[model samples]
Target: MPLLGLVSEYLGFFALLAAIVLVWKDSPWQKGTKVAATIGAMALLGAVLPAPPEDGAATVTAEADGKAAGGGSAAGVLAPASPTAGTTPEPSPRPRPEAADYRGMTLDDARDRAEAAGFGVDEHDASDEDKSIMMRLNWTVCFQKTGWTSSGTKTIDFGAVKNGAPCPAADGGAIPWPTMPDLVWKTWKTAHQEVAALGTVPGDHIMASTAYLNDQLPDEGEYDDWRVCVTDPAEGGDVTVDLRVTLELTHPDNGCPDPDREDGDRPDLPDRDDDGDPDYRDPFPGDRNRTSAFPNGLTGGSDDSSDGNGGGGGDHWNCPRTRWC
Candidate 1:
């Protein structure tokens, strides 16, 4: 079969050469016609010839055929190729870094540490003051929460306070307690304002009641005309959210009743010095010396006098001795 194939290829080439020579020299055709004939013969010859193999093409094809034949099933069918074979693999995502503690560190230091560990930092005031950390170096971290966000980023939140301040007993426990103020003799509106000034919700913490028995009460909006007669958990008391402050009020028409005196006839007056003498009756109510000088108004001399005891003469009684007197 090899010998026959070689002989047939040689014959085809000789026949093409003979046809070209006959059209150009022996045949009586025009110049253009002869050239066309020669070209057709050359095209036909090229179509019949086998194409040359590319470098390593035959070797690859032969190896593929050999593999298919050897790996075929007993029924002589070749197996399907693997879907992922010879494909470039996809790269995997990088692992997230572990969370770290940032408590007890300076705000600046905590931020730096968190960023270095491939984490984002969120900071806020732990004292519940809503104060901004103007100077990071001057603030210290009191607490921290470290976890991963839904977007796959590791984040750490820090609560901080000014340096030298003690951290709260627990997280989110740094809110300062409000102190109760003196609200007696003040209008209901003024009393509510005072409570609100202490950083408390006045409506939730303050309650009012009529001071006099059988007195009809008005709506809360009319409380501006009412006066406070007494307060629960009186002045200088520490107020908290759970504690309610109750105020005894008196209507504008009915004056405040005296809790200390009976018969409800005694009038309530401002005693600046608390010396039993009301400011209206006391000549020197604001003078500490006059209000606290002698016990029971005895004839004790004034300290400012030359005698040092106001004992210069009779009936002096330490009265009209000082400039205030």
Candidate 2:
């Protein structure tokens, strides 16, 4: 995200400077003394460069142009929150019930616990070993996508990497990324509408992990300390098109909050209320905050096609509002 803003601002400055130099090529300004003076002035101005706009600001929304929503990840625009108009009392915060047990708990058991505790769970069928060990207790918050859609078997495991034997303990473990395509290439084709990654939910990582798998990351697991939001576009028989975005949060590790630590214990962070159900609220469902960031477009490939590359990734293809032509 830092690199995106920096490159955008620098490119704009370079273009303006180049245009000025080209226009003055044959004029008196091109001569030795004048050219030197102009170059010096330009360099001085460039040195005092203005700061690039912040990424997580309100104005900057994600677009599907040449890339996926949040693919190029410029950061600005925070997701919308529920409205508050009437005098209805706000829901009280609550902690989830204790996890049943961890004895021989399979991946499904872990997923159930996390979801029951208020996190979203996305499954990526990684190698047999990775899948068996890593999935046990990882869960994140999930939102539903509306309109026409189909379910499938394949999944991309962004957070878990195969490490020979079983995955390490939640507190001290590491998941490596295979040398193949990482997050970017995983969604390059259009067949898959949902984009899921492994990381913590935004703004929830108070306790840092002891064993460093990915230090650049601020949170634990894929959902506990990471944030992910994805979109699925609905096809249009008419000229107009439509799309839906789903925000997700997953908890990867099992580190409890430390009251003695600076941030204080936050037992209330996960699905505090033992509701065993997800609260369905469309935070950005049209109207007041209607300008959705994800893009919707038609896709095309050869009529006679295969499953890989040339087939446009899979059974479908959709253009992004921000990254495609």
Using Cα atoms with residue i matched to residue i, what is each candidate's TM-score against the true structure?
Answer: 0.30, 0.14
For each candidate, what is the lDDT? 0.70, 0.34
- Model 1, 1-325: lDDT tens digits are 2232245767777777777877778899999988888887777677766786786677656666776789843444344555787888786754545667678899999999889888888998888667877889988898887777778888888898776566777766765555678777889889888886765444667788777653435666876868988777777876754567888787665567767776754354466866654454455676544543342343354343354453454445455534524
Residue 247 CA displacement from its true place in model 1, Å: 1.9
User: Model 1 compared with the native: what TM-score?
Assistant: 0.30
> Candidate 1: how large is its RMSD?
16.6
What is the C-alpha lDDT profile of model 2 across 1-325, one tens digit per residue?
2232245656646665665666577555546776676666566555555655567542333232323343664445345675688869876643333333322334455456546644444544333333434433442211111121124222211223222223324412332321211122121222122221222112221222221111123233332333221112112111111112222222233232342457532233322222221112212222221122222324444344556655554434433332343
Top TM-score hit: 1
- On a 0 to 100 scale, what is the lDDT of residue 180 in model 1? 73
